[model samples]
Target chain A: MVDQPLAVAARSLFYRKKRHRDLRQRFIEVLLFLAALSSVLTTIAIMVLLVTESLPLFEKVSIIEFITGRDWAPLFDPPRYGILPLICGTFVTSMVALFVAIPMGTIAAMYLSEFAAPKLREVAKPVLEILAGIPTVVYGYFALLFVTPVLQMLYSPFGEKLSEWLPDIFPYELEGFNMLGPGIVMGIMITPTISSISEDAMRAVPVELREGSYATGATRFQTAWKVVFPAAISGIIASYILGISRAVGETMIVAVAAGLQPTLTLNPLRPAATITTYIVQVSLGDTPHGTIGYQTIFAAGLTLVLLTLFFNVIGYFLSRRFRETY
Target chain B: MQGSLAGVRGNIQRRQLWSAIFAIVGLLVLFIAIIVLLALILQLAIQGVPRLSWAFFTSFPSSKAEEAGILSALVGTALVMLVTAFTAIPIGIASGIYLEEYARKNWIAALIEINVTNLAGVPSIVYGLLAMGLFKSALQLGESVLTAGLTLALLILPVVIVTTREALRAIPSGLREAAYALGASKWQMVWDHILPYASGSILTGIIIGLSRAIGETAPLITIGALTFISFLPPSPFKSDFPFLSFDWVRSPFTVMPIQMFNWVSRPEPEFQLNAAAAGVILVALTLLMNGLAIYLRYRFRKGVKW
Candidate 1:
């Protein structure tokens, strides 16, 4: 008789627990769905805000002029809205940054993935992470205080010597805050990004492939450069694109090291303002929102957003394809 | 016959030399990066270490470099991080759990997955603009710690979500099946099983996300956080019984990066030293967070390996 009562009690308790579980699960699932949806909502908001802010600027400045004109004089007396110089500046610095980033990054990635023993990699990774984790503002100060002065000391003499021969072309007059200093520092800033990504790509190359190359009597370098590089081409390209995207969007380094002069010069030895730096420069002055000055930053941000997003999409797809194989 | 043999030997020797050279070059690349890192640390240490003191942590910033301290900026940064974690952790884990477990293998899930990836790549400043429009202009929250924190929470949302999903995926599905078969609800299974297992990694991700947010300057700048706040935000608690207040949330704020940025731009060399000191503090904070994350990842990884 006691056993019967205990069994009945257990049955009732189980039923009640089941009922509570049902309601909790339903509430939690719906909450999670809303949370997940927020990401998409963020994207939509970014696009909508950029478009609404940028639209007014386009109405003021002709789209063709903004794209095609070789000058960017937003704060001038006449207020020329030509963004070509900013675009040119962005390209010039990014090109310089990539020049340093790609070669060094690829080589480092090769060393890390293919050559370094596991112990060495463990030691090296956190060091590289420290570099990667440095705030951009710190990099800005480094560029301004350290890199610029060093470059000036090393290059100004070369400029004076070269002026004897090629006058205009050889005489690369490096300024205190120029495209070169920030570009090089930015390269150092992003090297870990490229190196790590490419390292991942190289790591993903099956060990079998490397052994196969070794079986063919290939040198370590040859095996890595020829076989593993080809195998991970998609990922390497994606990493390059992402690195470029990051370099393009990088703001504070150029703002502090490369002066806020939007110039159409390809000479990285000279000061040139990138789109990001220009935005920072304007934002520093506190241009009231809704003014053309304020809206210009949003426009620049939109341009930056579009440019980075394009590469991000391409990089994403490329990496995805690579991931799908594994 | 002798000449032909010599030519072949020479070619092989040249290839070996080139291979050796390439390996050296690769090592040199890593060396250069290490050197740069050292130079930056040395630079900060030379200028900043002398100024690290109790006063530096206690006083508000001032025009005089000696009088200036990072107290306001430090408090603001801490509060901002707290807010960011509070907003991001729950929502991000929920989103990640939904995507990983609750959502079906359908287009909606795929869309959310892809969108998260894209959102991760969006520039921080664009998020700032969104915050400016949404929080400042539309909602009339004005420039406050809450606005900056919320902006960063949104910015790091993708990172947290991605990390959470990965952590959850690391768990074996056998546990889930056993729980369900035992008549446990989905929430109960997740609460009792999945979360405990994933909590280490989830915490690691949150720390890393906050570390990144702490160092972030552009978004906060874009949202109109002043570089010159001498007073602290209103206290989060008061003398009265309630002991909780939102006054700090409503007040203007400055963060470490913004304060550092302001100092670095000043004309005086003394201010530059102050900037360096603040930079060191910021760097220490970020490095500590990252180190904790790395340690957690390492410890939990070995323990969880089945």
Candidate 2:
């Protein structure tokens, strides 16, 4: 009877411990689920805040006008709340930045993935990452000081006499602070992003494919250009979209280098404000929270958020479309 | 016919020569990237190093560029980073664990996975906008260090989560199976075996994310963190009876990047030099964080076989 009691006690203890562990596991699982859910919540919050704050602006101002009209002077006596100038600025600078980044980044990726020795690759990767790690503000400084000065030297002469040769096509003088300066610096800042991602995509191309090209009497250049390039095109396009998204959302470089003057212009060598820089410009001054000036920035923020999201979604789909190939 | 064969052989040799030439050209292209990086460093160093006096680190920002210092901004940055790390690390690692370990291949798990990846690429300024509306206006936190820190936490959370998932994914599934066979529960298996193994790289990810936060300016600006603060917030540690204080969290603050940005905008040459000096300090801080992360990752790679 005593032996029976002792055995029962030991059995009960085991059951209790098992129950405790199961309960603890459930508790931790809940905690982790909440943690993971927080990220989804963050995205929802962003969309919600942007929509709520910007709805007021769209309600007061015509959405079509906001999208298509010419000026961005929300604080003027008459208040022209047109965002076309900001859109033009965003597009002009991003296109220019992409122009510099795409070719340079792709070439660097080709060298890194196909040509460089392993030792060289190792040494070079951190250097490029360091380039990537540099604060955009530093690039902004570089844009204003070094790049603007150099551009002044090279373009100053042409800028002065350009009207004589290409009337209505060129500015008579390019300001020290202009779209080209920030656009070029932004390109350099994003180069590492493009190169690293492209290198990954190119590296994923199978060794058999490269070897097969060589077996067919293809030169190294021929194999890289004809075979590998086509195979990696999807990945390349995805990275390009991501790069363009970066250029679009970049704030510091453009805000610091390009003068925060919201003007509608096609010229790259002119001071213009992008959507991101406009937000910074307003925040720099003391616009009361409830005022039209303050709310206009939210409208701008919504535009920027939507624009970048569109690019992000596109890049995501492009990468997914080609993933099965790998 | 022999002469034709000789011609074909000579063509092969010439093709090989040109292939070698193409490779050399590729190297030359890479050199251009290097030149860009070097030029940035050379310019910053030339402008900044000359202005790195003791006063630059000690004094508060002044109207006169000659007397301006980054002391208050540096303190604000450190304070913000501490709060950011405290909030981001736990949530990120927990989510990483959940996604990689606990969750089944169901829709919810996939949703969080996609959400994290998307959030990582969502521009940092968007995070700021969200923080502005939600934290500053709705919750009424205003432009305090607390709000900035929390905003930064959200900004870097995706980075932390993605990197943490990567680190945990590297741990062999065999380890999980081994723990399960030992009668360990799923959470127990994760806490005991997986976490300890992946901690090094998890730490590396956190450090890297924090480094990015330190250099970020756009979001903080949107939240209305001041560009000029002459005095430091009350110390995080109290000099009086209650030893540790969070009064600093609610205080007005400016960070190094904002201070640097403000000075860089001034028309004076002196302000440009001050901005460069501040830039050097900010870069040094980021590089230190990154170097630590790199070192930790190296150690982790060396220590782990799989």
Candidate 3:
């Protein structure tokens, strides 16, 4: 009878331990839920704050004027909040980035998936990602010191040719800091992002498809172009859209390489200010908090956010519409 | 029949030739990408080697800004990074586990997954505002290291969560079933079996997250980390150390990016050179962390790939 009582006590203790563990798990679950929810909540709050603060900007500067007006004298006594100059600059750089990133990224992904041997694939993928690993600040330095100098050197020989050609072919002054420098650097920055994703997408295509084409004696190029790439098109486009989102959001490189003068010009060679560059400029210069100058940055930030968000939506849609393999 | 066979052979030759051309073009793209990276490395190494000094590593920021070294910035960066990792890793891993192994496939779980994806894509500067509003002003943490670290934690949380989930998913179902058949409890199986299998992957994810957090500049600037700080942080809890201690919530500290940015924007030649030096440091740290993550990922793939 004494032994039975001790056994019962031990059984009760075990049950209590289970209950305690269950409670602790529930607590952990709640905390995880809260942490995840906080991210969403934080995003919502930022949107609200941006909208509320940006309202004054819209009120002061009409949407059309903000979007289309060419002058960028926001710091003058009578501030000009014509945002088009910045928008144009941002677009020019982003478009140039796309031009450089897309063909190269897609081609590299195709090569890695369809052409490279297994060992080479393993080596090349990580080497390509080194571009992603390099900090944006370094890319900025490369653009300013190396790329700018190289461009200047290349142009120096063409100076007389350009001077001869200016009236007929060129209509603007040549500047050291221009879209060509930053666009090329930004392209390099975005290349790895596109390649990594596109490579994944290409790899997702069933080997059977490639085998089918090869069985028909289709050349590897024909098999890749007519069969594999088309099948991988959706993923490839999604990768390109992702690259665009990255290009739009890039800050440091553009701020450094693209001079922060919001000029209204279509010329890629002339100095211009991107939206990110503008934010960097306004934030760094002497601008008191709660002032219109500070508010301008928020407005500019809102534009950048909305533009990127729109691209993200497009990217998500493309991924859903085009996703072939799981 | 002989003539037809000859034609067929010619067609095969043409196809092989085209494949060769495509292969060459692909290799060319790879070459260009690699060359750009090599160029960046060489440029940084050549410019930054001379600036690498004991004084550069140990001295504080100077009033003659061009003369300033990066000691305090490095310390402040380390403190912020350590604190951010401490806060973010546990929560991120747990949530990842829950989503991967535990959570029911319900609407709520699906919503959580979507939210995390969108959060990953959200620009980082938004997180800075969140820190400014939630940690800095509302919670009264102020523009200090702690707040900045917390803010960065939030920014990197989605990345960590996604990566950790992928890692957990890679653990085979047989392991789970075997543990359960042996009468191991759910928590016991996860703690003992699943986590060990997933640890390499999880570590890789965390390191990648750390790299992203360290390079982040926008949120730190938004949350009020100073562009300059002369003194090193005393401790994690020192209020005077900005984000380090709870005691000095209002003090300012400069991070590597902001400091480099300040120098780069200056018109002085010396500052520009120093910016190059700082860029080298920042790039080195980022690349090292990323290399570790990539290596870990390769290990995971090699060990686990079917």
Candidate 4:
């Protein structure tokens, strides 16, 4: 009887330990699964709402008209559905931003990574990153107040000289608020993003490469450009593409500095509108939530989302393809 | 042969010159960033320093222009942030802890990791839409500060998880083994030995993530934060408190950005100046939070060892 009681107690203890272990494992698994699920729910719910609202706009306006129309007068009585002007404006502004950001940002990264002393790199890197941490609204104010005035001064004097060279084709009015001003400000805003990521890529290149180049009597500059820079080319390219995406997605600076005209002219000095700016415009209006006018905001959002998604996909694949092979 | 060697040296020198040019260009980029920061700070001080007074922080929004104050918005923002931090940090840190310490090498874990990486890149407006459906439609939380906080929490979960994993990874596995060897259980080893050592890293990451969450305007706007709340909620969870009631949940609440947007969009040039002043305050707050987080991170990295 004593042996039976002892055996029964042992069995109970064994079962309890097994159950506790199983419970702990299950608990952790459940928590992680919930975390992952939260992300999916977020992505799916956004798509659904955007689609539901945008469907009404599609019903009233043809998809072709939305894509190919030259004018955007959504606030006017006869609301036009042409999205081309906004799309062109977005692309031109973003391209200008890219042109300004890439060379400057790449050089900055190179200087910090290859040229600057350790103390300088440490000091400069964080200060540059602090630019990124500044709020977009502040940048918007800077663009509206400072950048516009500076550009206006350049255009006022230069515009007359250029017009004299070609009177027939160049009848220019240098607007203080135009794509040029916003593009310049956007370029500055995106510089930190490009420099930080590119610097990380450059720093990842092994010191052995630098040492080997130097053994052949290569200068510090020579080793950085021919050997180290080429090695990190893919990452550098990826950073620039990421910068392009950011420039395109940027909202506040463009909305504030760029003039609110949806004209489809190719000129950089003209006041232009972007998709994000259009979304802000409609959202701020008195349009009812369920109306077609309101739905256009979702359509604009969908376009922005799709464009960013495409760019991110390309960037993801390229970066993954080169994943720090060192 | 000596002439050819000289030619090769000339080629090398040209390359070096180009490299110097590139380096100068890089320095130019950093210079532009610095110049912009300086210009913004100077502009803000020149314009906003005179206008910033007790009345600006304490008064209520008014159509009469001069009577405007951000008191209610400030309180509302604080309440939303505290609630957001309270709800988000626990779950975010827990999920991070599980993935870093407990999850074994398996497909399930890999799937979770990939999902989280992608989630961090999704747009904030999308998160807003999601909050509208989940909390507003399904859970019936409505468009209150609680819903807004939860939405922002969800938006930043991936960031928190990623940072926490990095922090945990920084801790060597030897410490975990040492805890187990002392006859500590798995949970005890983690809670006692691992968490304390990594607390500084986790706190720094959390503060950084929280700062980002605080400045986010998209998700909050989507969750339907009222653009104007005249009174504070009587209780934290009550429909209304200090100035407004919970009934305002269904109404549009204005945040700093939304308010700034309102002011700037007007044709009145005075509003643009007001926008600049408001922007200075907002920038100051964000920078302070960010600076603190960065300092904490630097301290943690320098002083601590695995």
Quick one: best lDDT, which candidate? 2
Q: Residue-wise lDDT of candidate 4 within A171-203, one digit each (tens)?
A: 776576788778887888788789888888899
Instruction: Report clash pairs, candidate 3.
Output: B144-B243, B145-B242, B145-B243, B146-B243, B236-B244, B237-B245, B238-B245, B239-B247, B239-B248, B240-B248
Candidate 3 CAPRI-style tier: medium
Worst 10 residues of 1 chain A by lDDT: A156-165
Number of backbone collisions per candidate, in order? 0, 0, 10, 27
TM-score (C-alpha, index-matched) for candidate 2 = 0.95
User: If ranked by lDDT, best first, what sequence of candidates would result?
Assistant: 2, 1, 3, 4
Candidate 2 residue spans exceeding 4 A from truth: A156-171, A320-326, B1-18, B239-242
Query: What DockQ was computed for model 4?
Result: 0.47
User: On a 0 to 100 scale, what is the lDDT of residue A311 in model 1?
Assistant: 80
What order do you get sorting by DockQ, best first? 2, 1, 3, 4
Model 3: per-residue Cα lDDT over A39-147, one tens digit each: 5676777788777767887888888998777787777988887888888888998888888999889889889988899999888988877678676767887887788
Interface DockQ per candidate:
0.68, 0.71, 0.51, 0.47
Q: How many backbone clashes does candidate 1 have?
A: 0
True contacts kept of each: 0.65, 0.70, 0.43, 0.38
Q: Which residue pairs in model 2 clash with each other?
A: none
DockQ category of candidate 1:
medium
lDDT of 3 by residue, B245-266 (tens): 4443344677888887777777
* Candidate 1's TM-score: 0.94
